[model samples]
Target chain A: MSLETLSENRSFGGTQGVYRHKSQATGTDMTFGLFMPELAEHARVPVLWYLSGLTCTHENAMTKAAAQQLCADAGIAIVFPDTSPRGDDVADDEAYDLGKGAGFYVNATQDPWKPHFQMWHYIVHELPELLGDNFAVDRDRMGITGHSMGGHGALTIAMTHPERYKSVSAFAPIANPTESDWGRKQLGAYLGSDESAWRAHDSTVLMTEKGYPGEILIDQGSSDQFLDLLKPESLAHAMMARRQSGQFRMQPGYDHSYFFVQTFMNDHVMWHTERLI
Target chain B: MSLETLSENRSFGGTQGVYRHKSQATGTDMTFGLFMPELAEHARVPVLWYLSGLTCTHENAMTKAAAQQLCADAGIAIVFPDTSPRGDDVADDEAYDLGKGAGFYVNATQDPWKPHFQMWHYIVHELPELLGDNFAVDRDRMGITGHSMGGHGALTIAMTHPERYKSVSAFAPIANPTESDWGRKQLGAYLGSDESAWRAHDSTVLMTEKGYPGEILIDQGSSDQFLDLLKPESLAHAMMARRQSGQFRMQPGYDHSYFFVQTFMNDHVMWHTERLI
Candidate 1:
């Protein structure tokens, strides 16, 4: 539960703190952005976990994403973690979609990656314990959302452990990772060639096999460059086949980018607010 | 007016086009960001000029501001200009503040800078003319805003040419450059050590002498690290001395960073929206 302050700055009567903690799960140092809202006399607040996509650091979402105002208004603290462990010591690949940038939110049992690529364990198990122990976060009212590869992280994490997260949403998520090239490559490299092992990480397959206890919301752009890889319809079809009711929206003419995310970001915040309240 | 498209990307059913045009004032290539809203049959829209601070390129404010959604809602096109012209051929000082970044939005009559540091003419005359001829911006419905040094730019530019801009605003702006070290060094180097010459570039002095015809709005952070250099009260005192009606708000516990800007950015956008509409 020990946390070391990496950096801190003041904004809108709140403190934006960047902290680093040694993780036992991944055996690597992890960084996260925590914004403690200006609260009324000694009142603890709800928390929201935001995951980012490939080739991103903890600072990207914290600095660029205009989500703090909503979080402040809703009395929620936001936690932003680095996409994956990054250092000269950790194993990496040249491709942008695999190795360091592409943790895919799973505990790898494979060689080279087995030591420090346990993002699933770090995010789901260790992160919550550290946040609850160190910060004033109401763990009972937690929610999660992310973009692209991180969207896949949010979905898989929430579906696997619904009790831990009260609400869930995503933007331009890779709905079926096993069927997409980016997903297949990463999964084959990290989880081996066994197709059965891939299903546990695919949201569409997971939804079809084990229906989520609560409603899931997803927002995708019609003009996304990776629209073929996202496969939102497959997720919808799977939900419908299982008689599962959830909200899946397809926005017209938007793309897979921060601009698209910023357009619909406030809506996701409000959505989580309604459920968390 | 020849326009060269430097880059273009699809976001939110519209396109973000970055263009480089040969400026008649500086005789150097200048860049600006244009957000063309989802065009519903080609309607002319109001234009907003966003000037950046020290050591920033045109791309910084364009990509990081998150001002597109509000602009789209207000049906306004935003233009972000680089803080200063830059090239190996162009004049540069060893420090980050003096030669290139410290354009001060004035026509330099001093050595080295005189040949190319004509941002004043580039912004006030050349930019509007080129934009009016090529883009669908209403020439009469233009507004201006900026941050820190750029804030000084907006105020001075608007005050200098009152007929051109309809409204003006700023975030964490330098009110009086004549009194601060950064400003004194820059103005002295760019315009020589004459106090009267520096008055034309100082917003506080201009406010006391010429006075803006329209209402001026400014937002300052209480916890700003550069509060000594900013001197918001100088502008406030000048406004008071002239009985000029303007809005100057100071928020508590905010620093002199983009995080502070992002917090109250919606207010500035809405303020311009009210004026534009």
Candidate 2:
């Protein structure tokens, strides 16, 4: 669980750091970013986990999200993990959506992809333990949020482990991945074309089986080019049938870009802070 | 000048756009980023020019500085220019400090760099006029700021054309560039070894000769790795001797990174907003 500091800087009256560690889940060196507000300088604070989309590293959100000042003001810590296990030895595909940068945040069950594509385990189990041990983050009060593929990760992970995460939110999440083209291709490659097995990692399927007791928040851009791939409307219908409550805000004239996420980032931080603190 | 929209996205309840245009001053196509807050949707807003440091493109400040949210809140439009004229035809040196990304905001008199390294004319005259013609920016209400080399550009440009810029500020500026290695090399190469001509583009020299009537604002990181190269102390002395009133607050335990800039970006935005509005 020992972490190596890649870089650290004072940002937004707090510490913004990047660290690398050997991961038991992925069996590779993993990098992650952490932002601890000034309040953490005195005492432990609630943490909000942020997972980036496909082809994004920890630096994507760290550099572009523009959420640090809001997080600092809210006195919350944020942890951003690399989207996938990365190394020369790690198995990868030439496609941007399937390999290297795209871990899909699932424990792969297929060969050539099963060993190191264990972001699900790395993020859900190992990373938290490391953070709780090494950083001033309150383990009891944790929330999760992310964008696109990472949004799917946040939703599915939160629902599966209801006791671990107190609140959950997402931006432009692929709400019903099992039915979408992207999901079918990725799940087929990683989980071996077993639709039954994918139910365990699909937010809509999992929620329909056993509804989440608490409310969720999601923001989607109406003008997003990938709106069809991210079937939010279908998810909303499924959640309605399951009796789960949440807010799905569809912003107009926005795209699936960091700009769209940054526009409403402060609101998301505040929503989590109110619940976490 | 005609400009083409390279890309545009919604951010912080506004528009973030990148544009490319053929520049008469530099004789090359140049790109710049613009952030127009929601206020611009209703009426013209004050414009702020942000010049980036050495070895940077327009994207550096746009992606990393984390200032757009604050600028949107303050109802200011920010224009970020490329540090240098960049094209395959543009002359360049092998070194990072002397070539493409390091324009030093000067009009080169030397052979190879002379044709396309006309950043002095680009920033002081052509860019502003182009912005005024194409955007919803109030031409009379404009302020300028930058980091390091760009910071030097802000100070020198604003002082030289005080009537054009309503306010000026900088982050980790190379204040006494005439006395630093970076300045000597850049000025020697660009202006052809004429020490006397360098004074025209030196902030310390300009301010000493004719003090700025309005107050200036500067933020310096005490722990900056290039603190010796960016001699704020020398600028402070020159200002005091010339009876110029400005605040040079040396922040403790900060560095020469976007992290430090983002920490104090809100304050700088507010400073410019107050004077411009």
Candidate 3:
């Protein structure tokens, strides 16, 4: 419980806060943003976790997504966790897709990354425990969503722990990471060159094979510059094949940016709120 | 006419764009953000100008203020101009308040700043003319609002050109800039040792002496760290003395960040929209 409060602001009748903690899973100090709406004092509330994509920290979604007002209106707390474990001692790469800001939400099995690139453990085990112990988080009614690489994380994580998360959603998410260039490169680097090891992390694979009955939503931008890298259609195909009741939307003229996310963020918040409640 | 597009994104049924142009007034290439809500292909719309604070660029309000959706809903455009003219050749100071990003929205009369620090001309004349010439702008229906130093700018500009601006608003403005530490330092540096000359730029003086008969609104945070420097109470006193038609509110527990502005942004947008319409 070595957590520290960094800054807190009153936003939309809610508390927008940034905090730092000594993370056990990554062996590095981690920072995250939490937006908790005005609730009855000491009331436990359902929380939705939002994972950011490449070259993003907790600040990007927390500041740019315009999510607080919508989330506050929906009566849910939203969390923005850093994309990767970061520090001077932590391993990094010159490439934006593989380095500190690109965690890929997986435990690194390869050397030069194994020591500190353990975001899977940090997100699934360490961060949740921290929130549950320190904040008014209702552990039984938690939801998950993310953008891009974080989208892949949300799907795999929700499928992996179907009982832990109540609902899932994403914005321009990487649906079939095993088949995506971005996913294949990061997976090869973090989980070794074995393609079989990546199947467990791919949402298409999970939906087709080990499906979850919980609520699911995915919004992808039709005009996204990285559309091919996301391969959301592949996941849509898998969802159809497995009869997974997931909402898949291809938003036209929207790109892969917070602008696109902010436009549809209210829907996601409302969706999660209804399901969690 | 020397304008260039930097970037553009579709947001909340509008277009968020960044543009650059060689500014004759500042003698520098200036950048600004413009959010044009969806309109009939060639329909002109009312515009609300938002001036940023010290050490800030157009990006702060464009990305963080949560202004677009509200503006789009209200059928108004919003412009975010940088705090000051910026370039390697432009004079700058070590202090956050005095140099590049702290133009005080005044045309400098002093050396080293006079040549390039013509933000007053740039903002009030050059930018507006450019906007009117290039965009779907309804020149007759313009409103202005800003935060911190930019608040001071909005008040003074609207009062100086009351016939030009249909509505005016501010957030945590330095009311009496001549009496404020940040304002005195910045104004003194930019306009020289003539304290009497600074009266033209002081919002409190403008409100008290040359009253703005149009719609006026001010939202100040009580918990702002720089509350002493802002002196919203002074403006409230001036409003009372002059019988000015202004709505002034002290928001409790809110700070001077975008958090406060965003919390009340919808109200501002609606207020301006009614008057402009």
iRMSD in angstroms, per model: 25.3, 26.5, 25.7
lDDT of 1 by residue, A143-246 (tens): 89899888999988888888989889888888889998859988888888898999889998988788677666677776788867777667755653443434
Per-residue lDDT of model 2, residues B1-277, tens digit only:
7899999999999999999999999999999999999999899999999999999999999999888999899999999999999989998988888879999998999989899999989988899899889889998999999999999999998998889999999998998878998799888888887799899888878877985667787777767889778877666546533435555556656789999999989889998999999
TM-score (second chain) of model 1: 0.96
Please give, for residues A55-153, the per-residue lDDT of candidate 2 as tens digits.
999999999999899999999999999999999988889889997888889999898999899989999999999999999999999999999999999
lDDT of each: 0.81, 0.87, 0.87
Which residue pairs show backbone clashes in model 3? none
Residue A131 error for model 1, in Å? 44
Query: Taking the tens digit of each residue's C-alpha lDDT, what string does model 3 give over B141-239?
Result: 999999999999999999999888999999888888898897888888889998999999999888778878764777776568887788765776566
Docking class of 3: incorrect
Q: Is candidate 1 or candidate 3 better by lDDT?
A: 3
Instruction: List, residue by residue over B1-277, the lDDT tens digit for candidate 1.
Output: 6899989887566668899988778768888888766651277778888888888878777777788877777778888887887777779899988777667788889989988899998889888888888878888888999999999999999998888888898987888899998699899988998778899999989987998877777777767788778887677556533544455555656788888777777788787777876
Alpha-carbon runs more than 4 Å astray in model 2: A1-277
C-alpha lDDT (0 to 100) for residue A131 of candidate 3: 94
After superposition on all CA atoms, what RMSD does each candidate show versus the true structure?
A: 22.7, 22.4, 22.4
Error of 3 at A242 (Å): 64
Chain A TM-score, candidate 3? 0.98
**TM-score of candidate 2 on Cα atoms, chains taken together:** 0.51
